[model samples]
Target: MNTSLEKVLVNVVDQHGAVYTVDAMCERSNDEPNSFGDCIRCINIDDEIIKPSLDLHFHSNKTGKVFKLS
Candidate 1:
């Protein structure tokens, strides 16, 4: 049996419900360590000025389902 976990694509959502892919977010961030975790931390910080009010969520590229982060 081929045992492998399905990879779920993570995405960033703005306050206005605008969805952005991780790569796109990293490009817009322009941080030294342009990584998914770093970019998300920066965006989620209280004093985030780059992209304030950003939230992490699960996005399905296949089914187009968006699950908000709680």
Candidate 2:
């Protein structure tokens, strides 16, 4: 239900093929609007964020549709 985060999906070819996603959030800094350097210092770097979304397809012999998986 939280729809504020942004995400990007990346698919790689491998034996145990899986899709990877990069997620991020955008927030405002608590400082004067003109202080660009000060805003960079206010960013939170101690959080671990994982986005829950997926899109996957299987590897095939001809066109990579070999298996049915979750």
Candidate 3:
């Protein structure tokens, strides 16, 4: 798979239901073998680069399931 760094737009929703669109740097790979391709590196929020934690848990609204990020 070919890997490259890409700039992506990410939509973030706050606790107060405020949504913000931000730019993030991510490592992207071609989906030759599998579907998983992008890995987020850092998010640019208010001119600051913030590295997010990968150990967080996410709840899916459609599936109503909790998934852990590895």
Candidate 4:
């Protein structure tokens, strides 16, 4: 498959109805890397809830999980 490097953000909810966001950048180099800290990396982000306008960097500089946003 043709995999390209990308970054995405997701929403996270606490015990309450409150909302939180996170960034999940995915890249397929030698293997793949991604993040899932569920932390807000950008604001005013809204993309059909499919993709976030913002990006993620709360996780370590190097992650090893491939998170597909689509």
Alpha-carbon deviation at 63 in model 2, angstroms: 1.8
Q: Judging by TM-score, tell me the better candidate of 1 and 2.
A: 1
Q: Compose the digit string of candidate 3's lDDT tens values, residues 39-67.
A: 76665666656655554323334433333
lDDT of 1 by residue, 19-43 (tens): 6544222232333434344344222
Specify the highest-lDDT model's number.
3
TM-score, per-candidate, Cα-based: 0.23, 0.16, 0.58, 0.28
Clashing pairs in 2: 60-64, 60-65
Question: Which pairs of residues have clashing backbones in candidate 1?
Answer: none
Give the per-residue lDDT of model 2 (tens digit) for 1-70.
Answer: 2223223223323345543332223323334243322112111112333222233323334443222222
Q: What does the lDDT come to for candidate 4? A: 0.36
lDDT of candidate 1 at residue 51, scale 0 to 100: 32
By lDDT, is 2 or 4 better?
4
* Model 4 alpha-carbon drift over 4 Å, by segment: 26-70
- Report the number of the highest-TM-score candidate: 3
Residue 11 in model 4: shift from native, Å?
Answer: 1.3
Q: How are the candidates ranked when ordered by lDDT, highest leading?
A: 3, 1, 4, 2
Clashes of 2: 2
Tens-digit per-residue lDDT, 1-70, candidate 4:
4556456655544223445565544444444333333222332223312222334322122332222222
